[model samples]
Target: MLVPLVIGMSAPSGLEGGELAAVVARGELVWAADQEGGGPHVFPDPDAPQRLTGFEVELAELIAAELGVKARFQQGQWDRLPLLLGHPADCVINGIELLPERRRDYHCSRPYFAYGLQLIARRDGPLDTVETLTAPGPAGRWRVGVLTGSAAELFLRSHPELEVDAIGYDGTIDSLEQVKSGVLDAALMDDCIFNFYADRFAGLRAVGRPFGGGYYTVLTARDTPRLSTAIDEALGRIIADGRLKTLYDRWDLGGRQQILALRDAAEIPVATRRSLRELAIETLPLLLSAAGMTVLLACLSFPLAIFAGLGVALGRLYGPAWLRPLLTGFVEVVRGTPLMLQLYAIFFLLPKVGLALPALVAAVAGLALNYAAYESEIYRAGLKAVPLGQFEAAVALGMTKWQALRHVVVPQAVRLVMPPVTNDFIALFKDTSVCSVITVIELTKRYSVLALSTGRIVELAVITAILYLAMSWPLSLLSRRFETGQEQRP
Candidate 1:
């Protein structure tokens, strides 16, 4: 889930020479955050999508000014924001909960924003409180949604006795929408986020007093201790001067939970790291399950893409001339766009027109459509490569044009394209990672979550890569066998 970004950025102003001196030289504090679907933390202004606004935005600016530098925002996925530290980002100012696991991996500043888990339910729903939710329910368990890789998810999963199904969504607002539509019985998110978005989602009400308190802390690379110290001091100054409170009040984040921000830095608990063997033992099953998802997504989509692409290829080559332009245009459009955008459109945009697809279905459909464009090109080439003699020979045997295509040309084309088609299947396995943005938890997303929580990036990543190889190796060998067979055949 960690996207590549350039590194070698300087740290903040307080540091003298070495890597820490870059911020003073550039006079910019490059902070990483995810503005997309990141409400109340950092999100685009509704009036002007290009402009970013949020309490965290102001907090970043405040810290930047305190460091005597300008703040520049770097956009990244929320779950992968920490990975930007020390590279493209001087620090991360998104709502990164100061969990013990994250603190164990990265340098964490003192708390700047206090928060807690807030449960949201339909205003007229029978479930009234967390206590009520914990009580024995009907035959079906209540489906409660939380943002994937969020502290809310951790808190919810920690208590199996709660007896609710914890569904993960890519965004807090997405979960709220599910609640509003009755797709979910309830949702849990940061209290600050709930406060910020409450008016936007009118049908939902807070189900109980906020629980499972935590604080949002700034994170920097472990090597940037000076920058981390400066950030901590800046946060302390912001809190002591009442500026933090004023910012919170402006954002409606002022509440009793805000007191959590006042704890001494030493009060933060130190997290213990587990050995790699222990971590592997614990996470292997989850990774295997996620790998199963990766396999399922690719297996389900590639066949569909193959069939659809073949149909498109045939239509362009042999069907009505009028249909050719439309099919060609489809190939152009789908090939021109990113698969992520296609999935986003299917999962998010389609919901507006009353065509909301379940996450897995949307993911499969998006991957199928996106790859079908490339598959069409491959098939088109394969069909074109067939010699004119093949069609003529079939026609000389009294076969119709359709019969000639079905009996002779297309089969040869499929054989010609089989290797490339298998190659695409391998590629589609990797592309399944993009489906994570739609809340489809596959291998890569699972690796990211486990790596973040367990601080075992390389170990989990190697396992994930091996799982991918294991899945694709058989196909690769099959493709080679087919190549050898064709080479031997005439």
Candidate 2:
């Protein structure tokens, strides 16, 4: 099975080689960050989308220059960027918060930026203030969005008494868009991020004062003490010499908040490492919960794919001449495009045509439609493999064309396609992970979140792989049994 092949790759490498020395020898400081985080941190220049420009981008270069190396950028998902440390990247320079738990797992550089959670909502919305949000609104629970695995999410989750329905998004921009569209009552994000995106979303306004303040520090692999020390020194140099101030002012972030970066930073103690068993005990529930969502998506989509594929196959093979080419084109188009693009169009672009779907529904529809095209080709071939003589024999018994095709031909075609159809269902379990882009939490997404938070990539990945195998193994056995039964039949 694909699961075993993937599980074999989950073993992580050790940090035996000196991280800082390697970077110096190469004359390059490779830093990882998520450009998708957007704005004052790091993002593509709006005027020149191909060129990335942000304060963090400049900050990375400054630190690299101080260390006598050129800075190179490696893109990764925001939450999972830490996983790239000690391999392709020496340090992570995104707006990663400096938390005690984070310090425990990774070496964090001195503060370059200070941020706090900024609550945002529609102008004059019901949940404009934190007090209103704390109280039960007309909707009973306020639906608030936060970037998943981020400090804002942690802050919101810390207060269980708020009774808010926390929705996790992959990016702050998406959460803002949701607030604008009235899908979310509010969104909480880094104050700098909201400031960066404020003018773009005019209808949304900052709801309450920014809270849960923290410093943004560059993170290095735990083993890279030298590299972390170098980064901290570089940050101190930048702050003392006013280069950090110049960069902040250029990015419109030179405000009272900038003072936090200037002050003597307090050292946060590292957290105690959790044993593998303890981590599994703590995170398994979250992963299993997410797996349930994955199962729900697969179960809801695969049957629709099968039925829709059947219709397309029948239309191409036996329907009117005028419609055959249209069905052919539909299948070709669906198969030609990427599933991600199809999902993006359905979830993000459909709103333009007044057909905005909820994230779960959109994910299921995208998976179903994409798989239907492939299944149609399989069904088409299976239908074509049936002999023309069988239809004539049925007609010789005075059966109508419809009755003959249904009673005589379809059963054989279905049998021919069953093995492949079952295999597709098996694949769907893994494919559901892609739905995370649209913010439908599934196994893979949950693994990334848990791995990032716990710094236990290998352990969580193994567990996640096992969960995926658990899901698809039964289907694999069933498909094999069905194939063997077919082989034995006379």
Candidate 2 per-residue lDDT over residues 1-490, each given as its tens digit: 2343235334342344476777889899999999888888888988999999999999999999999999999998888788777666789999899988898888888788888789899987876677777788787889898888899888888898896978888777877887887777899999999888888999989988988778888998877777888889988898888888888888899744596554955777777899888997899999999999999999999999999998899999989999999999999899899898898788777875777788899999999999999999999999898899998999999999888879998888999888999999998888998898888888898888887788777777789889998999999999998899889986
Say which candidate scores most in lDDT. 2
Q: Give a tens-digit lDDT track for model 1, residues 1-490.
A: 3322112223332333344567867899999988864778899998999999998899999999998999999998777777677677889998888888888898888877777799999998888879977776554788888887788889888998887887777778878877786667899888878878888989899988989877788998877777778888998898878788788777777633474445533467779999888998999999999999999999999999999999999999998999999999999999998999899889877877778787899999999999999999999999999999999999999999999999999999999998888888888988999998877889888888887788777667778778888998998998898888889989
How does candidate 1 fare on TM-score?
0.90
TM-score for each predicted model, relative to the true structure: 0.90, 0.94
Kindly report the root-mean-square deviation of model 1 from the true structure over all alpha carbons: 3.2
Candidate 2: regions farther than 4 A off: 1-17, 261-266
Q: Where does candidate 2 clash, by residue pair?
A: 104-271
lDDT of each: 0.84, 0.86
